[model samples]
Target: MVKGYSNHEEQVFTKIAELRTSNYDSKSINDKIAENQNFSGIIGSLNLTVENYPELKANEEYKRLSENLVIIEDEIALSRKYYNGTIRDYQKFTQMFPNNLLAKLLKSPEFLMFEISENEKENIKI
Candidate 1:
């Protein structure tokens, strides 16, 4: 068999494969989110790499792939927003006055907001 190129790339891709095969229900939210960040960061780095290559942009295939990646990134961002909104809605339902009493009786699960670690926040621009 032909050997792989970069060990780092292989490891990154392996993590991605694991993410695809693993059951989300079995993972803690933190684990799923860390995977999500790693996936997104890798995709972003690829996009940046493509943008840096004007010769690649000149090729129709590369242009098409870059466009597709951007669309995918946008969709992922939108989906995350929707997911966070859902969590907020659940929190509201469980925390409201009358509903809260019932929620307490039901032992409703606590929901966490979509939050970045302080280190990550420091790296974010605008």
Candidate 2:
């Protein structure tokens, strides 16, 4: 599980770096990351392995790492939720009466929400 996760993470980071070097915008880069099947599969596989292996689950190091991962994941989710909320508010503000005229004159770029695919919506076993 660790090997799979590490390899998938490396690949994702490499791809993101490459995309950034190629001048992809942040939203496009984020979309590419969200659509990465290998990364998603690795996460799913790790979750399954943990669920299936009682011994692994019982290991002190594994438990510690798992708890840390859970906390990090929750924090990331919260951050994403907060970011999306801010984007929504900004979009609404831009579309409102006086702000609409200013936005039109400035031609502001639309904010993209950090979205997860349907498969990502499933809870991880851990």
Candidate 3:
């Protein structure tokens, strides 16, 4: 039972880590497109496992890592929601009339609201 539980935890954590890396990748691409330096590669490394690691995915440790990753992914999603909400609010405030005037006077750059695709919107839960 201990082994099973640990495996599950590892899997969840691994999934969460994967999701984080993916989000970082998305942000990196966005930054690159916005003329900023891409930094996603600094977070993690990737490769073709068959050629590089040779059946690493089939190993028990790797399986446990993958399972644990899923649980971690939920926490990441929550964190992202909080950040997205904050960014959205900042953007909205910057667009308001008096706030817009104040922002202009302060030379404040507008916050970029995070964009979610239609598929993401459709998948959102209350």
lDDT of 2 by residue, 5-41 (tens): 4575586567656655654454463464454434445
Question: Candidate 2 has which clashing residue pairs, if any?
Answer: none
Per-residue lDDT value at 106 in model 3: 94
lDDT of 3 by residue, 14-102 (tens): 76565556645546534533321122121122212212444655678766855664565466567657867887888789889999999
Worst 10 residues of 1 by lDDT: 117-126
What CA root-mean-square deviation does each model show from the true structure?
Answer: 5.2, 4.9, 10.4
Which segments of model 1 are wrong by more than 4 Å?
1-12, 51-54, 115-126
Stretches of model 2 off by over 4 angstroms after superposition: 1-42, 49-54
Candidate 3, after superposition: displacement of residue 1 in Å?
A: 30
Count of clashing residue pairs in every prediction: 0, 0, 16
Task: Give the number of the best model, judged by TM-score.
Answer: 1
lDDT winner between candidates 1 and 2: 2
Candidate 1 lDDT, 13-105, residue by residue in tens:
687787788897788776777677777666555444545455655678766876776687578768878879999988888889999999999
